[model samples]
Target: MTQQPTPDAPTVLLVDDEAALADSLALWLERRYRVRVAYSGREALQTFDESVDLVFLDHNLPGLSGESVLEELSRRVDPSSFAVVMLSAAPGDELADLPVDAVLTKPVTKRDVFDAADRFVGDAPEAKLD
Candidate 1:
């Protein structure tokens, strides 16, 4: 099972074949949102659920490509319910055929992740600095 989200914070699923990257993103993201890390497409499919408010999908995975996973997700639920951001080195226009809220280029930075979170799910309560 994925990490359970607390009542207040939104859940974020980070799917990437790169273990280091996924872990790094999860570590930083956990300060705000409830974070789940899936190292493969199969794991991502399993980890995702209704609770997820945002998904950061890496396009070029070793097994089930992000496009395929997105297709399956689209079939399982309404696309508009949760936000999907496809991460890829390819140009955004090339991915126009894909159903995604936004396309972020790799190598994504902490700022990119934070921006996406804010844009999609709004700020997590803990993200605010007094």
Candidate 2:
């Protein structure tokens, strides 16, 4: 059996090559969860840490492929430590072979994203104030 991490506000790593889209999604997620953004797979890998409770990875990325990033992450993090959600604008057979927790199609709504985050992270925390 896989050991689960202690429940907490989810820390999501959002990886996308599109800077504008990535920023928009990051902003949206930041309102609820701890959000991290990476413009490429290499950057995503660099930003990855044990704190990341879930991942939203874009299928098509420049430089290293998202699959490669996932493979590397699988090797570094415990299988149960985090969940991987593959996001793609286009469908492909290659994604079927990945060991991700879930796959979501692009043009994703805020609710859909949050729902996925909640599924991985559990309940949301009370908003923090300055």
Candidate 3:
């Protein structure tokens, strides 16, 4: 039997205080998925809409912490509407209880980014409904 393709491309929100890094990662991910970038957690929550499919958040940010952003996102969107992944240079237990899909350490590769994105967006056939 032939498999049905996904209805829409996954939309990723990449939040980092480093503008260059965020830009580069957004550029790289844009080739394969719809990508959005924010320099801080506050900016991320402000820029966020209901269309996001995945979120790659840096733990340390200027205005708000990544954990705060995750909390805001969790409140605003349904659990299945998007997957939140924390990306940090310093990985710790603080993120363990956060409502997130995954926690990825920094110095992340292109392959790793893509793999994580795929894991969040690829498996769910009904991800777009919400």
lDDT of each: 0.87, 0.84, 0.81
Q: How well does each candidate superpose onto the true structure, as a TM-score?
A: 0.89, 0.88, 0.84
Estimate, for each residue in 1-130, the C-alpha lDDT of model 1 and write its tens digit: 3343345898999999989989999988887898889988889999999888899999999889999988888888888988999989776666988879988898889999999998999988754443
List of clashing residue pairs for candidate 3: none
Per-residue lDDT of candidate 2, residues 35-59 (tens digit): 8999999999999999998899998
lDDT tens digits, residue span 38-105, model 3: 99988899888998889999988867988888888888878678888889898888878877788888
Clashing pairs in 2: none
Q: Work out candidate 3's RMSD over C-alphas.
A: 6.1
